[model samples]
Target: MDYMTLKEASEKWGISSRQVNYYCVEGRIPGAVKIAGVWLIPKDAEKPIDGRRKNIL
Candidate 1:
């Protein structure tokens, strides 16, 4: 499965890295995996809130 790093996901979503981290901490985004002290977001995972396939900017 393809995954995007926190930086990559933040860039794609037009959000700051801090905001992404907050979401991860709050469990607002799904399919986030933490490995080796890094967060990975699945490329095909749906956006947490609305079950949408696309990320909100």
Candidate 2:
């Protein structure tokens, strides 16, 4: 499987690297793995939806 660094994932997902790290740390990112203190995300992994958002009507 292909993998991407946290930075790449952050850029592609349009989110802060810190947030990606947090997601990885929190196990919110599926197929995300930590290697040598760095986070490796699956290249095909879809960005998780933010649960903190509320729908406005």
User: Residue 25 error for model 1, in Å?
Assistant: 1.3
The alpha-carbon deviation from the true structure for residue 13 of candidate 1, after best TM-score superposition, in angstroms, is 0.6
Please, what is the TM-score per model? 0.71, 0.91
Query: How many pairs collide in each candidate, listed in order?
Result: 0, 0
Off by over 4 Å in 2: none
lDDT of 2 by residue, 1-57 (tens): 999999999999999999889899999999999999989999999998888898889
Give the per-residue Cα lDDT of candidate 1 at 21.
Answer: 77
The runs of at least 3 residues in candidate 1 whose Cα sits more than 4 Å from the true structure, single-residue gaps closed, are 46-57
